[model samples]
Target: MSQQQCACPKCDCSVDSQAIEKNGQRYCCEACAIGHTDGSTDCGHNCQCGK
Candidate 1:
Protein backbone atom coordinates (compact mmCIF):
# COMPACT_ATOMS: atom_id res chain seq x y z
CA MET A 1 0.00 0.00 0.00
CA SER A 2 2.54 2.56 -1.06
CA GLN A 3 1.31 6.05 -1.86
CA GLN A 4 1.91 7.24 -5.36
CA GLN A 5 3.80 10.41 -6.15
CA CYS A 6 3.65 13.11 -8.77
CA ALA A 7 5.52 12.34 -11.95
CA CYS A 8 6.88 15.86 -12.32
CA PRO A 9 10.64 15.49 -12.25
CA LYS A 10 11.08 18.62 -10.14
CA CYS A 11 8.15 17.95 -7.85
CA ASP A 12 8.22 15.97 -4.61
CA CYS A 13 4.51 16.00 -3.87
CA SER A 14 2.48 12.87 -3.36
CA VAL A 15 -0.31 12.14 -5.83
CA ASP A 16 -3.11 9.69 -6.14
CA SER A 17 -3.63 7.15 -8.90
CA GLN A 18 -6.41 9.39 -10.27
CA ALA A 19 -4.27 12.50 -10.27
CA ILE A 20 -3.81 14.71 -13.32
CA GLU A 21 -2.22 12.64 -16.05
CA LYS A 22 -0.33 14.21 -18.90
CA ASN A 23 1.66 12.40 -21.52
CA GLY A 24 1.58 9.38 -19.28
CA GLN A 25 2.98 11.31 -16.34
CA ARG A 26 1.05 12.06 -13.16
CA TYR A 27 1.07 15.56 -11.71
CA CYS A 28 -0.08 16.81 -8.34
CA CYS A 29 -1.09 20.22 -9.68
CA GLU A 30 -1.92 22.04 -12.88
CA ALA A 31 1.31 24.01 -12.80
CA CYS A 32 3.38 20.87 -12.71
CA ALA A 33 1.25 19.31 -15.40
CA ILE A 34 1.47 22.26 -17.80
CA GLY A 35 5.08 23.01 -16.97
CA HIS A 36 6.10 19.49 -17.84
CA THR A 37 4.51 19.86 -21.26
CA ASP A 38 6.93 22.68 -22.07
CA GLY A 39 9.94 20.89 -20.57
CA SER A 40 9.98 23.38 -17.74
CA THR A 41 10.15 22.35 -14.08
CA ASP A 42 9.46 25.78 -12.67
CA CYS A 43 5.83 25.01 -11.95
CA GLY A 44 5.04 28.50 -13.36
CA HIS A 45 5.76 30.10 -10.00
CA ASN A 46 8.49 30.60 -7.41
CA CYS A 47 9.88 27.11 -7.21
CA GLN A 48 13.20 25.27 -7.37
CA CYS A 49 13.36 26.07 -11.09
CA GLY A 50 14.10 29.69 -10.11
CA LYS A 51 11.45 30.95 -12.53
Candidate 2:
Protein backbone atom coordinates (compact mmCIF):
# COMPACT_ATOMS: atom_id res chain seq x y z
CA MET A 1 0.00 0.00 0.00
CA SER A 2 1.13 3.52 -0.70
CA GLN A 3 1.61 5.91 2.18
CA GLN A 4 0.13 9.41 2.38
CA GLN A 5 2.57 12.27 2.66
CA CYS A 6 1.60 15.61 4.20
CA ALA A 7 3.49 18.48 2.64
CA CYS A 8 2.88 22.09 3.61
CA PRO A 9 1.42 24.08 0.77
CA LYS A 10 3.49 27.07 1.86
CA CYS A 11 6.85 25.90 3.20
CA ASP A 12 6.69 22.42 1.69
CA CYS A 13 7.75 21.07 5.02
CA SER A 14 6.99 17.54 6.08
CA VAL A 15 3.72 17.91 7.90
CA ASP A 16 2.31 15.42 10.31
CA SER A 17 -0.42 13.65 8.38
CA GLN A 18 -2.73 14.04 11.32
CA ALA A 19 -2.38 17.82 11.16
CA ILE A 20 -3.31 18.21 7.52
CA GLU A 21 -6.64 19.55 6.35
CA LYS A 22 -8.57 19.63 3.12
CA ASN A 23 -9.67 23.11 2.15
CA GLY A 24 -11.64 23.24 -1.07
CA GLN A 25 -9.66 21.29 -3.67
CA ARG A 26 -6.34 21.86 -1.95
CA TYR A 27 -4.59 20.15 0.93
CA CYS A 28 -2.61 22.13 3.50
CA CYS A 29 -1.26 22.03 7.01
CA GLU A 30 -3.12 24.17 9.60
CA ALA A 31 -0.32 26.70 9.84
CA CYS A 32 0.00 27.43 6.14
CA ALA A 33 -3.65 27.00 5.38
CA ILE A 34 -4.86 29.57 7.88
CA GLY A 35 -1.72 31.28 9.06
CA HIS A 36 -0.62 33.00 5.91
CA THR A 37 0.90 36.43 6.48
CA ASP A 38 -1.58 38.44 4.46
CA GLY A 39 -1.11 35.72 1.85
CA SER A 40 2.59 36.38 1.50
CA THR A 41 5.26 33.69 1.03
CA ASP A 42 5.70 32.22 -2.40
CA CYS A 43 4.99 28.67 -1.18
CA GLY A 44 7.69 27.87 -3.75
CA HIS A 45 4.92 26.87 -6.13
CA ASN A 46 3.25 29.56 -8.23
CA CYS A 47 1.00 31.28 -5.77
CA GLN A 48 1.01 35.10 -5.67
CA CYS A 49 3.78 36.13 -3.30
CA GLY A 50 1.37 38.54 -1.60
CA LYS A 51 2.99 41.37 -3.52
- Clashing pairs for predicted structure model 2, backbone only: none
Candidate 1 segments exceeding 4 Å error: 36-51
Question: Each prediction's Cα lDDT score?
Answer: 0.67, 0.44
RMSD to native for every prediction?
Answer: 3.9, 6.0
lDDT by residue (1-51, candidate 1, tens digit) is 356777766676777865788898877777777775565556533455313
Q: Which regions of candidate 2 deviate over 4 angstroms?
A: 1-9, 24-28, 35-51
Top candidate when judged by TM-score against the true structure: 1
* Model 1 lDDT, residue 47, Cα: 59
Clashing pairs in 1: none
Best-fitting candidate, measured by lDDT? 1
How far does residue 33 in candidate 1 sit from its true spot (Å)?
0.4
